[model samples]
Target: MTLQKKVIWITGASSGIGEALAYEFNKKGAHLILSARRIEELERVKENCSDSEESVKILPLDLAETHGMNDKVLEALAYFGHVDMLINNGGISQRSYAVDTQMSTVRRVMEVNFFGTVALTKALLPTFIEQKSGHVVVISSVMGKFGTKFRSTYAASKHALHGYFDSLRQEVYDHNIDVTLVCPGYIKTDVTINALTGSGEKYNKMSKGHKNAMPPDEFAKKLIPKLAARKEEIYLGGAELMGVYLKRFVPKLFNKILKRVSVT
Candidate 1:
């Protein structure tokens, strides 16, 4: 279906890629459900949409509040009566070495990035089944495809999404439910500063490479069309995207390069 008439619900919509997606989809005439923990920020995104008067609903939510996901999702269903698509984009990043990271931090990352995403997807599955049509767009990362230093838990969580969503795609293919996993590299966003370190503190610092990364708006512009067409797996970013293959055919080379990569 054309995005012009689609109803999309986006998480992590307060800023970055999610906010950009909200704007891009609005330009295409889609009804949007913009969600994030920051209500004011979500409202700002809605205001920035192509048509502010149009049907753009703001639902502030925290993915980390895993227990309340079902209720929030049900409330979302009530917003439009049916959700045409769910963009499972709310997630955290890792900024510490695996050994140095705390178990609590790892679990928290998994909860927000993997389990919480799955929970929301499961809650919405019955709705898709009843209609026999829907799309699930997951914003994964190149790190999801291949592991790197100081980001073990983040990589694992993203990798888990790939496995789960890929399987779900096949299971529901016959029912017209499509799943698209977006693997983005270093598109500029606050993901780095907000990432959790080994001690579970916010990194609060930008990586040197991130300052020169792709703009979120441009990334979203490229992504919206792909989602509309329902591509199963799409990769974004520059050399980062190439890392996927570097890990496959040249493991040693990949390890050598990653060893110099720093999250600090």
Candidate 2:
């Protein structure tokens, strides 16, 4: 879909990839609804956009607030008459070993990353159906494609996005509702630092790997166009993008490599 004048809602727009996406789309002439828990951060991003007041709206939301999602989405949707694309990008990350992780941590991760995304998508489905044309872009992870150390819960949450969206794609293919699942490797983001440890607490420290990853703006620039074309699935990263192939064609080698890689 052409982004020009399109109305897009991007969750997790307070920073990182989502924030970069908001700017990129703004530059491409898309009207945006930026959301996250930090209203000030959202405002900062909005200010940076050209025609900030006219082109963008900020709606602060906590995706993990399960009970208020319906109301939150209603309020967010009030900004645009119709949402052309809903970017399900708001989510938390896990930072503990799976075996050591508490059930609460797993549930919280699933709640924010999986259920929250699915709920928001469901809430907007009727609007898309009415329009008969819409796009759902999910920002998953390269880890979604494979299991990694200290990230079993996180991997599971992202992997669930693939399963849910892939199924929804087939179900809605006839309705002109396009779904794009983005599996990105590390991009410069606070996702890792904010990732949850075993006891359901934030790690609050950036991982060395994340600090050295690709810049979010560059990653967003590379990704947004593919999304515009309604690609089914796209992977963005460096050598880690190759893991998709390795996991499928060389499980033994992939396992070996994964063993050597550091997740935290």
Candidate 3:
């Protein structure tokens, strides 16, 4: 379905893919509810949109705080009286080995990346059910489908999203609710820089692969059309896309390849 005039709520709107998507959806004439922890940054993103004042609304949200999500959802719904789409894009990444990573760090990752998204989706479900039509788009990762070095906890969080959303899709099928899981491989963004190290400190450095990855705007441009087509899942990236296929079709080889790749 077209995004024209649709009230689309996007998390992580301060930067990266979420920020780029705001511009793309704005170009499609969609009314936007831009959300992130940084209200000032969210406003900056909104101001950059085509018709900032009329089409965009900033809703600062901290996804890690699950207790407040229901209230956030209610406030979001009040924006346009209904939300046509909800983009589950708010999450954190990891850049540490499982052996060295602390349990608290792992829990923080899961809390923000998995439970937070689930909580918000649950809060919005009643509205979508009443409306009888809504799209739930999740920005998962290639790691969700397979294990990789230095991303054990982060990968686990994403994998959890796949399992939960896959089940939700089946349960909501008859309700006219659609779930699209977008597994993005490496894309040029601050994800790596902000990734948590084993000690839970920011990695603070971009990886070589991310430096050469697809630009977020370019990824967003390609994503919108697929989303409009209502695809259940789509992978967007460069050579990393091969890993998703290899893991499914040639597990042994994929395992070997993962071991040799200089993931960082």
lDDT of each: 0.88, 0.89, 0.94
The deviation in Å at residue 218 for candidate 1 is 0.4
TM-score of each: 0.96, 0.96, 0.99
* Tens-digit lDDT track of model 3 for 84-162: 9999999999999899999999999999999999999999999999999999999999989987899999999999999
lDDT of 1: 0.88
Model 3 worst lDDT window (10 residues): 46-55
Q: Write the per-residue lDDT of candidate 2 for residues 47-75, one digit (tens) a residue.
A: 99999888899988888876777777688
Evaluated against the true structure, the overall lDDT of model 2 is 0.89
RMSD of candidates 1 onward, in order: 1.4, 1.2, 0.7
Which residue pairs of candidate 2 clash? none
Alpha-carbon runs more than 4 Å astray in model 1:
261-264
Per-residue lDDT for 1-264 in model 1, tens only? 577757899999998899888888898888899889989998888888766655799888888777887788788888778789999988889898788999999999999999989988888888899899999999999988898778899999999999999999989988899999999989899999999999899999888768899999999999987887789999888777778998899999888987887645
A best-first ranking of the candidates according to their lDDT comes to: 3, 2, 1
